[model samples]
Structures are given as C-alpha cells and as structure tokens.
Target chain A: MAVATQDTAIRTGRFARALIYLVLLLFVLFYMLPLYVMLVNSVKPLSEITGGGMMALPQVWTLEPWAKAWSTAQIGVQPTGLRPYFWNSISMVVPAVAISTVLGALNGYVLTKWRFRGDTILFGLMLFACFIPFQIVLIPMAAVLGFLGLSGSTAGLVLVHVVYGVGFSTLYFRNYYAVFPTELVRAAQIDGAGFFQIFWRILVPSSGPIAVVCIIWQFTNIWNDFLFGASFASGDGAPMTVALNNLVQSSTGVKEYNVHFAGAILAALPTLLVYIVAGRYFVRGLMAGSVKG
Target chain B: MAANATPDFRTRLQTWLPKLVLSPSLAMVLVFVYGFIGFTVYVSFTNSRILPFVGPDGQPTHDLIGFTNYAKLFSLSHWEISLTNMAIFAGLYIVICTLIGLILAILLDQKIRGEGFLRPLYLYPMALSFIVTGTAWKWFLDPGIGLENIMQTWGWESFSFDWIKNRDFAIYTIVLAAVWQTSGFVMAMFLAGLRGIDNEILKAAQMDGASNWNLYRRIIIPQLRPAFLSAFVILAHLAIKTFDLVIAMTGGGPGRATELPATFMYSYTFSRNQMGIGASSAVIMLMTIAAIMIPYLYAELREKK
Candidate 1:
C-alpha cells in the first residue's frame, strides 16, 4: 500500500509540473506570436516577407521602410508634419494628466477627510460622472469649444481630455484614500494640520502608488485618444493618433504597408517605453483602480 | 465636538477652501461632460440634418420632430448593421479576453522561474495604441505581403488566413487584436487576486489529500470571484465602447461589417454630417450602457457584505 501511494504521488507531481510547463509555453506563444510576426515582417523586404512564412526570420532586412515612414509617410514636405502632432500629443497629454491628477487628489482629499455639506451627494455625483459615456457630450463640447475660441488648438484638446480624464483619476485617488485608515486624517486634524497642508505634506507624498496609477491611466487615455483629438484638432494641432489615421488611410491613394508599419511602430514607442520602465507600478495602479471600484 | 456648533468665520472659510479648490473639476463636470450629453440628446429630437441647426430654416432644419429621427434610425439598414456589429464585437471580446486572461493568469500563478518576464510580455500590449497595434495586425494578416505569402513560400500550399477582407470574419480580426492588447491587464487582476489568497488554506486542502482539481474548483475559484468580477466588468465596458480597435484594424471595412456604435456615430456626425442621426445614436449608446450598468451596480452593491 505504501509503495503504491508513493508511486501515485510521484506520478501526480510529474503531471502537475508538465501541465504547468505546457500552460506557460502555450500562453507565451499566444502573447508573443503576433508581436513576433509584426517585427519579422517589418524588417524584411516585401519579396522576402510575402514569399516567406510569417514565423520565418527576415532573409534580406532593410531599414528603408523605417526611414521612409519617418521622412515621408506623415512627415510632409510642407513642414507641419508628424513632428507637430507628436509635440501636440506630448504637450496635451502631459498637462492634462498633471492638471487632472492634481484636481483628483484634491477631490479625494476633500471627500475622505473633510465632510462638507451635501458631501455624500457630491461624491455620488462624482461617481455618476465616471459612468456617463463621453459621446453624449460631443455636440455641446464642440459648441463650447467654439465659444471658448478653442476649436483648433492643442490646448482645447487638453482641456477636454482633462475634464473626462478627471473622473477616473478621482476614482483612483478617492478609492485609494478609502483604503487608508481614517485615523490618519482624524489624527492630522487633531494635530491642527489643515486640508491642503495635510494633503500636500502627508497624503500626497505617501500616494506614490496611486500617483503612478493616475499617470499611466491618464497618459494612455489621453495619448491614445483619437475621438477627442480628431474632433478638437486638425492640421498642426493634431496628435499622433490623427496623423496615424492619415498615414494609414489615404482615401484616394494606394496603401503603403512599409510606411504604415513604420508609423505604427513610431506611434506605440512612448507608451511601450513607459510600460517597460514603470510596468509594476502601472499594474498596481490598475489593480487599485479596478479592485476597489 | 459640539453638536450643531456654529463654527467661527475662519474655520468655516478654511473648511470651504478645499471645495473651492474642487470648483475647477466641478466646472468641467457641469459644462463639458454633462452639458454636452444633454445637448446631444436635445439635438437627437430635432429635425437637424447635414449640420446641427438650432431652429428651422427654409430648407429642412432642426425642428422638434419628436420621435421621427428615431423612427428613421430604426428604418436604416446601416443603423441595424452597426448595432448588430457592436453586439457581436462586445460579446466575443468580453468572453474571449476573460477566458484567455484567466487561463494565462493560472499558469503564471504557479511557482515558476521566468514568470516575471512573461508577466510583462503579456502586459506590454495594454500599453500600445490600438491604431499602432492595428497596423501591425494588418501587415501581419495581409494576404500578399504578410503572413499568408510568407506561409505559402514555406511549402504550405493550402494556408489561407485573410479575415481582414472577408466581411463576415473581418470583425473577428479586430477582436483578436483587442484580446491581444487587453487580456494581459485582466491577467494582472487575477495575478493580484491569486497573490492575496491564503497559502495555509491550500496546505490544509493538501493535507486532506484533495486533488488539484478539487482544490481549484472548490477553494480557489470561489476566493477569486471578486477579482474575476472586476476584470470582467472592466473588460466588458471596454468591449462595448470599442471603436479604436475597429478603426485601427479594418476601418469597419470590406463593406462596413465591423462598424461599432462609436465609429458609426463618428461617421454620421463628421463624415455624413447627419448630426441629428448621430446625436440620436449617441443617446441610444449612452442609455444602453447605463441600462446594463445600473443593474450590475445594484446587484453588486446589494450583495456587498
């Protein structure tokens, strides 16, 4: 009986180990396959790419496509090219995230520590704000943008993204604050620390995780944003997203796969770099944003 | 602390200062977000065409034609197709991403070397723009100059994968791209949940000689419900609102087979200049999300212990 039981135990251990390996191998393939295909095809000459299998290594790799994508695809001869839009994306997103996150911190501070008149109602309304789809606001937003003389500026796009972006950011900050012991706030108040004082000195400093979360969420939402960018900006004020559309979709022209791949790669570089550098914090940020809510 | 204490003027002002700081965000919430939604719903009821007109012109203008715009919306084949496409995309996207995410999460949850690197590989897709990702997918999925040609050259005479052009299967390509981009994030949710599970419970089950399947089915799955719920809700919301994936991958192409509500509204408002119809569609989209969400929220909130 002892011998049989020991044998079965050994078998189960081997099976479990094998199963784990198989699952991991399959998942990695699933995750990496498309990316591998993209990278392999991007470097290969059209002949090699089309004539060879997607999984095959590039036989005759060339850098010409990347150069063409940068110099010609959306980078026009007229000077106002992808560079302007690249800057536009950077300027709009950075400031929008900054402004929205700061305000979100303030809202979270107020909601958690300072109980004001109709405070619960205010919090409810803020919660309600997050759920509403932004499409409902396009016409009115256009009208408002027009009225404010912001219809064709990068700043206008920033303003709108911040407005929409704040809801989620606030939810992040507020929910994080909820996890923090209320005694911290009560103790701070007892120590004669005011709202802004306590928030800036104590809460904000310790809120590194939530802050990272806010930055990543806001950055992605704003940078990858197409609808708001398209609606708000055109010409020089356009972001990378709009430029990408123009580069990929020329209504009356032949499609350029080489340039399109180049543009696509160029477009994804920023967020990808951010992910590589600060991915763990970003995950923590998302977890806090999602799980609590 | 005195009940109903009449606070001093300085205390009152100091207390109100944070609210003052909050005014900027409040202003945004009031005018930009909610205001536009209200205005769009109003526009939907009007007889507006081409562009949004506030009042009647000698030509057809934005007049209060009641349910006429909605009447016309239901009659359009384009509208029906777009709605059908959205439903299909959302359903497939939510289900596939969750299933893949969960399966991957479980594998990574096991004690394994190199699991850390794999976690980032899965999550990296979440960081990319759909437009960029879409471009990559298109090239890889292209017939002559991409995967298919490459495959043909490798001596596989019968290897055809061209869903990008096939109207029926075009949207599935979009779903595949999206799942690639988003499943990793859901996997992170499950990873975090798995980390939080008490190790002692697993050891106790092991002592009881419980099989792995029994341990997972009876103990672990139930413990991970919150994590699953959160991941599912976020993924479901994203799927319903998917427009970037479609535009980036197929552009609702091969005959508008991949049209989503957001993209459809965009075309109506900008391309077709049918603001009335566009506004009407936006209202419907908003209401549909709200309808689905409120019930989910109620159920979850009520169930909270």
Candidate 2:
C-alpha cells in the first residue's frame, strides 16, 4: 500500500513538472509571437497578406519587399532608401562607440587606481549624468549644436551620442576596476612604470570581457537612438531609426506592410545579432550597470 | 643633481596626468550636462518663441517672463491628457511587468528543460529598438488587417481586437508593446536575484518538510526586495522617457490621445515653436526623474559606504 502511494506521488510530481513547462512554453510563444508574425508577414506578398491569412506561411515567397525596402522605398521625397541611413548609423555608431569606450576605460582606470580627494564625489557626479532625462537637454543641445555650426549633421549626432554615452561607459568601467586588484598597479608602478604605462600594459590587457560589454552596450544604444537622431539630424543625414520611423509612418500611396517590416528588421538586424552572439555579456552589463537600481 | 630634478618633475607630471585626462570629461559634463540643464531652466522662464533668437550684437536674447510658461502648461488640455496617460501607462506598465517578470523568473528557476533556448528567446525583444517593436506591434495590432482580421478569418466571426485603432484602447496597445519588450529584462534581473539566494536555506526548509509555496512566500519572495526595488526604479525611468515607443506606434495620434510629455516637448519646441513652454515641460520631467533618482542614488552610494 505504501509503495502504491509513493508511486502515485511520483506520478503527480512528474505531472506537476510538465505543467510548469507547459506554462513556460506558452510564455515563450507569447514572447516569440511578434517576431514570428513579422517574419511570416514580411516574406508574404501583398496578395496573401490581404487575403486575411496573416499567420499562414507564404505559398509564393519573394525578396521583392526586402529589395524595395533596401533601395526603392521613399523615406521622404528621397527614394535613395534606407541604404544611406544604414551607413549613416554605422558611421555615427562606430566613432561614438570607439571614442567613448577608450575614454571610459581611461576614466575607470584613473578613478579606481589613482584615488584623490573628492574622486568618489566626481565619480558620483558623472554617474548622475547617466539618469537625467534627455528631454531636459534637447533644446539646449540643439542650440549648442547650432552654435557649433553642426546642426543637421552626422558629426553633430556623433558628438551628442559620445557626450551622453560617457556616463554609462564610465559607470561600467568604474565598477569593473573597483574590484580589480590594485596589486598589479602597485607592482607595475614599483617597476618604474607611470600611470598610462600601467593602464595600457596591465589593466587594459585584462579588460577583454568588460570591453565587450561596454562596446555592445554603446553600439546598441547609439544605433537604436531616435530622439537625438531625429532632433539633430535631417534629410540625407538621418540615422536608420529616424529613417525607419519616417518610412513606417509615411502615408503616401498604398501602405506596403511588407516593406515596413523588412525595413524595421533591417534596421534592427545589427543589435539583434549582437544580442544573439553575445547575450551573456549583455546581461552581465545590465546587471553590473543597474545592480543598485 | 640633474637626475634628482628629472625624477621630481616626472613625479609631479604623473600625479597630474590622471587629473589631466579626467579634466576634459569633467569640463564637458559641467558645460554639456549641468550647464545645458541650467540653460533649459533659464529658457523655461523666458518668453522665447519659435527659436531662441540672437540679437544683432551676436548675443542670444530672450524676454524674462516668470511663471508664464508654467501657467500656460497647466492650462493646456494636451498637457493634462499627457499626464493622465503617463499615470495610466506607468502604473499599468510597472505592475504588469513586475508580476509577469517575477512569475517568469520563478518558472525559469525551476530548472526546466531547454532553459538555454528559452532564456534568449524571451530576451531578444529587448535587443531590438523600440522603433522596431513599435513597428512590428503596430502591424500586429491593426484591426482591419492584423490580429482582428486574422481572428475573423480563423472562424471566430465575432472576434474583435481593434485596440490599436480605438483611442481609448490605443494607449493600452502601447502598454502591450512596452510590456512585451521589457518583461524579459525584468525576468533576467529577478532571475539573477533568485540565483543569488543561499541554497542552504531552501534545503533546510525542505528538510523541515516545508511546502514549495511556503518556501517561496515565506522566504524567497521576501529576499527579492532589492530586485523588486531595482525593477521599479528602472521601469519607472523607462516609463517617463517613453518617447520613441509612442511615436513609433501611434505618433501620439487619434487626435493626440496618446501624446506623452516627451512627444509633447518635441512638437512644442521644434514643431509648434513653443520653446518656452517646451522647456518648462522638460524641466518638470527632469524634476520628476530626479525625485526618483536622487533618493535611489543616495541609498546606493550610502550602502556602499
């Protein structure tokens, strides 16, 4: 009798586990539903989409929408398409990411290793910059850009991204270097190495993981930014997010849903790829960055 | 004697190099960050219209008109609606996200099958931009040709999911999209918190014949306070800065029903040429964010000390 009861308990336990998994699987589906819909609808021709079969797999698959989205779709009056904007985003992001990462590394090294009076206070001030709403600075930033004669230019956008981006980059590196061994710095210094020398040789070489985190974080943010891009850039200089917004919201002739989806996917492709490739580091970055949140 | 002089000079320079490298960042922050904030606050109090003008003498000028912009902002119906919408959006977004995130984290912590594939699948939306999410969900929620139409064709004849087109329901669609994009991130945060809990406590409770529900409710959930707080702070900030999502999804549309403060600020300052009022609204938003952030930062820094 005891054996039978034990068997029943085991059976119920297995059933309970299955139930938990089923719920989880349902959530996974819920999360993935939008992406599935995007891919399915994107590949289908307009005829099938309008046929009231949104979820059905495409019987006649074509790349025409993708092609048109890349080259022929009008973002505004310009039919040159998202191709230029894609490159525009790349140009802005690359320089912004590179310069900000290097500066953040230097700041982190100095703040952590070379402690001076009020250094923590200074670090705190920089950290505070990260959380301020971008709206507060929009009008003045525009004026600043205008004063510098960089209004409506990609370089202006780059400058905006780099300046705003420094806080986050510094936060990442500071936390990373705080727990890092100071013994190495002391040893290097005792060997007659100077500040930059110790940083470049000892600290920087060990910054592989945090560097990935910083670069990916900055790349995703700068690439995906719409507010700065929209405000600071205009025709021919707009980044992909702004361009995608215009393309999707543009009410011209027939709304090519396929083209819109393709354009959005293309615009999002890089960051999505980064997440897929290095998601572990991305999650680590978030944890480290927002641990005190 | 010459060698000693060289060493002394090198020591002084080395001490200053860290400061030298740090000074530029400090100066940029003072001007670009704090200075711009000061500029915005100053602009809010002035009667600047259309553009901030430069006088013929090449000095920028604005007429000082104190509290006029603030008064005007309170009287505007759109501003009232924007505040209402933010309350509704922020309230719902935070509650729903936290609940769903905690639940998902609990489920995932069960060490279910296919954890690896499931984790990233849930998190990939966070990788995509709000623009992409807004675009994708806009299509999904469109009544005529999206989910509603799809449901009708699936033989649910009375099925109607037209929230995207309904003004009253339109804001909810934004909530839907925002929740979808963010819940997984919250899950990751909670999951990290869950993993950090001491396993011996759980084992001890299990040995004492405590039920799973009791273990979670009595012990585990209480310990997730930090995670809960972090999630609230992050979500609240994201809720306030909800510009790109609303713009991409609805364009604050159906006759300004979904107009958020961020969108309002953009349109007023740049489009409508109401720079002073926009600046005022921007200042209000900064204050709101600062209210939450200042205390949070103080707690964090103090905890460290």
Candidate 3:
C-alpha cells in the first residue's frame, strides 16, 4: 500500500509540473507575441507585410526598413534629423538625471544623517509633493519660462523634468537611506569624517542597486517624455518622440505604413538599447526598491 | 535599528547642516511643484488665454473672470464624453491591471521556472515610453496594414478585428496597451508582498490539508492587501492622466472616441490656442484626481501610521 501510494504521488507531481510548465510556456509566448510581430514585420518587405500575416516569419529578411528608419525616415523634410535630436535628448536627459540623482543622494544623505528641526515636516512636504500631477503646472510653467526667456528651449524642459523628477527620486533615495543602518554613518563620524566625505566615500560604495534604479528610472522617464519634450522643447531641439509625432502625422495621401514603423523603431531605440545592455540590473534595482544595504 | 542614545543638541546640529545644504531641491519643490499648481488654480478662474495677457510691467496675469471658462467647460458635449470615458478607462484599466498583476505575482511565487527571463519580458514594456509602445500598438491594430489585415490574408477573409477604428471600442485598445505597460510593476510589488509572508503559515496550511486555492484565498490574498492598494492607487492615477498612449495609439481620433481629459486639455491648450478653456478643463480634472487621490492618500497614511 505504501509503495502504490508513493508511485501515485510521484506520477501526480510529474503531471502537475508538466501542466505548470505548459501554462508558463503559453504565457511567455503571449508576452512575446507583439515583439515577435514587430520584428518579423520589420524585416519583411513592405509589399510582403501588406500582403502577408503579421504572425508569420519573414521569408526574405531584409534590413531595408531599419536602414530607412535610421537614416532617411529620421530626417524627412522637417530638417530635424535623428542625430541632432538624439544629441538633444542625451544632453537634456543626462543633466536632468544627474542633477536629480545627485540632489536625491544628498537629500537621502542629509535625511539619514541629520536629526534636524523640521526635518520630518520637510519630509512630509516631499511626500505631499509626489501626489500632485504636473499637468496643472504646464500652463504656468510655459508662461513662466517664456517670460523668464526659457521659452521653446532645452533648459526650460530640463527645469520642467527636474521639477517633476525630484519628487520620485527623493522618495526613492530617502526610503533607500532609511533602510541603511545609521551605524555606518556613526562609524564614519567616529573616524572623524565630515558629511560630504562620508557620503562620497562610505555611503556611495553600497549605492550600486539604488544608483542603477535612479539611472534607469531617470533615463526612462526623461527619454520617453512626450509632454515635456513636446511642450517645453521643440524645433531642432525636439527629442525623438517629437520626430516620431511629426513622422506619423506628416504622411499625406495614402499612409506610409513602413515608414511610420521605421520612425517608431528609431524613437524607441534608446530605451530598448538600455534594456538590452542593463536589463538585469534594471529589474533587480526596481525589485530591490530604493534601498541597497 | 540604531537610535541616538543621548539628547545631544550640538551633535544633532552638526549632523543637520548637511540637510540644510540640500535645500535647493526644496526650493524647486516649493516654487514649481506646489506654487505652480497654486498658479494653475489662479489662472483657471481668470480670463487668461493664449499668452495669458500679462500686464506691461510683467506684474501679474491674474485677470480674474470668475469661473467663466468653467461655465463654458460644462456646456460642451465632449466634456461629458471625456468624463465618462475617463471614468470607464480608470475603472477598466485599474481592475484589469490589478487582476493580471495579482495572478502573475501569484504564479511567479509558485516557484515557476525561467522566472528571471520571463520576469523581464513582462517588464520590458514598462521601460519604453508610452510613445514607443503606443506606436507599436497602432501598427499592430491598424485596419489596412496591421493585425486585422494580416489576419484576413491567412484564409479568413471574412474574419474581422476592427476595434481600432471603431469609435466605441477604440478605448479598449488603449486599455490593452496600458495593461501591458503597467502589469509588471504590479507583479513585482505583489511578489515583494508575498515574499514578506511567513513560510511557516503556508506549511501550517498544508499540514492542515488546505487545498491550493484555499491557501491562496484565505492565507495569501489577505496578506497582499497592501500591495493591492499600492497597485490600485498607481493604476488609478495613471488612468486619469493617460495621455501619451491615447495620443500615440489613436490620437483621440475617430471623432474623439478615445479622448480623456489630458488629451482634451492638450488639444484645447496647445493645438487650438484656448489656454483659458484648456486650463479650466485641466483644473477640473485636477480637482477630480485630487478628490480620488486625497482620500486614498489619507487612508494609506493612516495604514502606514
């Protein structure tokens, strides 16, 4: 009886495992379907795509759309080419991300190290700031920027993003610093280190996970930003999304389906490249929350 | 775990100076974040339009019209449609995303294989801006050139999946993409919550001969309330302000079918040059968001306390 029961349990386990794996496999397939379609259609000739099914693999894989997407489709008649826009995005985003992260780190450092008067009240104010959306600020900011001589410029956009980005970044770094032990700071202090020195040397060493979160979050936020890039910064300084918007909206008469997809691929390249290179770190960072220690 | 043992005001002050050094961030938060909204409220009531009609000395643009724009906002036909669509979109997006996230999180917690790869795959959509995702979705949904066309070519000429162009069902497409984009964060949050649960409780449940479903229903779901609330709040917030996806996917087209308040505000403010009308619309939307969010935020604070 014991032998029979053992055999039955083993068989049941195998069966359940098989079923679970099958379900997971299907789920994976479901998740990848759109990406798969994008890739397959991207490679296929325009005629073939318009003539064929999206799910089917490309019979004659061509790099034509990618080439077109990267080069000509990027420039168009608008004269705002991909390279310049790419530069604009990078320039604006790098500073925005860096400034926000630096301030966040400093804020985190101060919040953690300092037991100050009105510190918790300040922290509460920061929390309150996060709940309010930026849409309300759009008109006021535009007017302010225009009045302050920052209208239709990259600097204006940077300020806008920084204003928006600070709330989340501070929360992230503050919560992260909260999880780190005060003993570390105390030890650094016992060794006669000042606040800046301690943060630069001691606190930063263990900030790998949190920094990755900051970089990824900041990168994604600034890169994919449509509203800010559209409103504050446009013309030659327009980011890829602006180009994308123009591209999709510009095609006259019968729509150029291939070109639209191509433009989109160009616009999406930055974040996609980030994921490809630092995907693991990105997920791990987010999953780990803002804390590193 | 470490707390200051002594009440040393000098040491505290010494430590506190670093925080003061970081006050510039607070300045930005104060002026742009809090103050800008105050400015928005002031503008919403006034008769500001296009350039905001500032005085010659650059003194102020507070030409108060006493809610004329607000009155005009309610009399419009699309306002009702926009509100209804926003309510529906918020409801559907939150419910669907939360449900999928919870299920995915639970499934992941079952010790499934290939979790590392699969987890990121689920999350990749979140990293890309909605512009990219929306662009991809549009291509996939376009009637003549996308999935439906492809579907028809494959020996089903009569088969139709034409929701993308239909004014009525186009909003659902936005929901689908939004869900795809946000579900991963939900899953991760729930996964964190699940990991926080005591393993002993699960073992005890198993010892008591509880079924898998029973264990999840009674033991797991109860513990995941915090994660659920977090997911729900985030989704609800995103839903009310969903602009990029609608703009990229459908452009609030097919006669304003996919129009939410954000898109509506963008069109009126930027495209049509009616800053007063747009600002008024946005102000109302802000109030609505605040109405939902303040209670939720208070409840969350209470729970945290």
Which model scores highest in TM-score? 2
Local accuracy of candidate 1 as per-residue lDDT tens digits, B181-277: 8988888777677776777788788888888788778988799998878877777667767877788777888888888888888888878978888
lDDT per residue as tens, model 3, B124-222 = 877777877787788788887777787788777887877889988998999888888888777777776777777777777778888777888998799
lDDT of 3 by residue, A125-225 (tens): 66566656557888888889988898877788788788777766776777678778899889988998877788889888888777877788778778898
Please write out the lDDT profile of model 2 over residues B14-128, one tens digit for every residue: 9899999998888888788999999999999998876546877887777889999999999999999999999999999999999999999888777566777788888888778
| Residue A88 miss distance in model 1 (angstroms) | 1.3
lDDT computed for candidate 1: 0.75
TM-score for each prediction? 0.90, 0.96, 0.90
- For all predictions in the order shown, the interface RMSD in Å is 6.9, 6.9, 7.0
TM-score of candidate 1 on Cα atoms, chains taken together: 0.90
> So what's the TM-score on candidate 2?
0.96
| Runs of candidate 3 exceeding 4 Å displacement | A1-16, A74-76, A79-81, A190-192, A284-293, B1-16, B55-62, B292-305
Comparing only chain B with the true structure, the TM-scores of all models are 0.89, 0.96, 0.89
Judged by whole-model lDDT over C-alpha atoms, candidate 2 comes out at 0.87
The deviation in Å at residue B38 for candidate 1 is 1.6
Which candidate tops DockQ? 2
